[model samples]
Target: MASTDAPPLDANRYRQDFPILSSVLHGDQPLVYLDNAATTQRPRCVIEKIVEVYERQYANVHRGIHWLSDQSTDLFEEAREKTRRFINAPLREEVIFTTGATGAINLVARSWGDANLQAGDEILVTEMEHHSNLVPWHQLAERSGCRVKFIPITDEGRLDLEQLPALLTEKTKLVAFTAVSNVLGTINPVVEIVEQAHQAGALALVDAAQSAPHGRNDVQAWNADFVAFSGHKMLAPSGVGILYGRASLLDAMPPFLGGGSMIHRVTMDGFEPAELPAKFEAGTPPIVSAIGLGAAIDYLEDIGVDNIHHYAQMLTQQAHDVLEEVGGVRFFGPPPAEKAGIVSFTLEGIHAHDVAQILDQYGVAIRAGHHCAMPLHKRLGVAASNRASFYFYNTPEEIDALADGLRAAKRVFRR
Candidate 1:
């Protein structure tokens, strides 16, 4: 449960923190940014931190004894600590830095899949996963002689949890799925999924790319074996993401990349891997981006995640009601309060690309396409759809802008 009585988020004050939001995209109209599912605008605090790191302390981390290198290394490790605490992980050693969510999931599949999976083993995933979550496992199955299984999704976009009992078995090696569907905005029951996976002697990996932006994520509470998310979607810079694995699991998994910092000792015969996180993080990590992520986390903490969740729910509910009244729009997702801030819908007799273009002309930005979940779209029997995803900084007025844009799109395309 989340607290609703918290004071209003001071949107005006918070809006000031993101300077780019004030900039005009078409030189006249304000940018009604609804494409948060793709990437979020960075706050001034995060930008400042990135600039500060490069200007004040720019050096290669982990090998130099000089002052600048030492300082950079300290700041980078501090960022890792911030990530661990943000997710409520029991140990900082469990956090591994990667390029983004996609890279992190690939790391898991490559390392753990190679080490543990044998011929005829099965990996279970869901239909609502982003391509990042699905492709790696598919590739792993191809290479490791493993098979992939999918959990079906209902027409309303919820996972058919009742089917899980039959899906899990002793041969199941891993169960990887998204915490929330990026396109449908479906919030999966992660705890129940984890419990079911463990019951069958399988590990669980959660793709938290969509959930982390709108709410608090406690890896311990979910008891997930591994969780991955992107920083850019959570108000930080692009090119940096996190992978949180239980310390023991990460300790046993082999290194994903073989290079510089991940080696404790190099021999002519072989190279010994470094400790827990370093073992997985090869080469020079994204130092400045990690610092930016730390600042972004601090900014979110100041605003309070609970308030962000409430604000998003209010916005989505308002849009749902308006879109329902419009009569031709069909929305996909869990009911308003039960999901994240994303809303995906398709209008009858209107192509998604045309609708998006018309919306852009009105200074309203929304995502339009398969949203990287092509299987889910195919399951839903639609070629594509338009999505309007919200964040803490978005206002109710923007929702009205989206509605007006949709109405205009309908009129323009009604030939």
Candidate 2:
């Protein structure tokens, strides 16, 4: 059954903006790229933005007074401003650039956690966190003699919200969780969670690696202490990530890395760090990637994030319905209404990798494995699963192709 209420979306025109979408796959099959959870295909604007930077205005930022350096610096800072407005941050300096989401999370766990957490403090994370969000805290706990605790998840892959209040206590130093689960596709209640954390006098950190690409990310509205996301996952290039920290909190925390541009003054004995953002962003930053990210933001804004989110939800619903009728598919997450645009499942008697390979033969790109959420996978009692994540450019016709490809995989496996 197709959704009658799905908002009208012009996917054909949007697909034209991504050049790789028209390319043929595996002999003659059309490419049905569904591996968006890993990374989204870059639009022509974003690609050209990177190329234009390298071809014309490439230079080191903030150090030299030359024209190329000044141009690069302005573009780089403009990217920060773009991101700040994109997420609705109160201060532009709060948006710090890093290598990726992993780097952003590690920055908080190392700098903020080290400065705030003590021997008896607790760091609360949820079971559905990606390793990038979980491991850094675990490392912090090991070093600080603090404890790392996880909020449980329901069988349907929803966060067990009822248990959260009891878990949060006066000893809790921070509540770190994902805005959207990478594997489960569950959109967690960020505002509610942050409120709870504040009541318990703890800071809240949101890993928006999945959520930032799908919908609005307002740090002010959520009252989040920190928010982290990667540009590549949102149609920008890799090697660039964002860490949105509260100005006061960022100012209090020590520098994570030490080098050029992040220092205000240096003596033979020690050094003074730069202001918010640059204090955390040591060394030369990802100049071209930042410019590309700005262009990606511009592209998304032109289409509107709300429209993309709604269309993607409709596509997710279509895929969920088709897969549910396939007879042997076992789903890992909540129903489509409860999820965003990701669907993770397994075909009976067929390994996830095998399922993925068969689908690839049909030119349908999908992901197979734990998706860097091994703890969540372990809790779900599945060793691995196949995932098909959708973006706004995806269509109902593509969902049909995915269903047909899955049926072909079933036939090949004799299941």
Best model per lDDT: 2
**lDDT (tens digit, per residue) of candidate 1 on 201-313:** 99999999998998888999999999999999999899999999999899888999999999999999999999988998899999999888988998898888888887887
TM-score of each: 0.97, 0.98
Separate clash counts for every candidate: 0, 0
Root-mean-square deviation of every model:
2.0, 1.0
Candidate lDDT scores, in order, read 0.90, 0.92
- Put down candidate 2 lDDT per residue, 1-415, tens digits, no spaces: 4567746579988999999999898779999999998999999999988988999998999888899999999999999999999999999999999988999999999899888889999999999999999999989989999999999999989999999989999899999999998888998889999999999999999999999999899999999999999999999999999999999999999999999989999999999999877888889999899889999999999889988888878888889889888869998888887777899999999999999999999889999999999999999999999999999888788888889988998899888
Cα deviation in Å at residue 130, candidate 1? 0.4
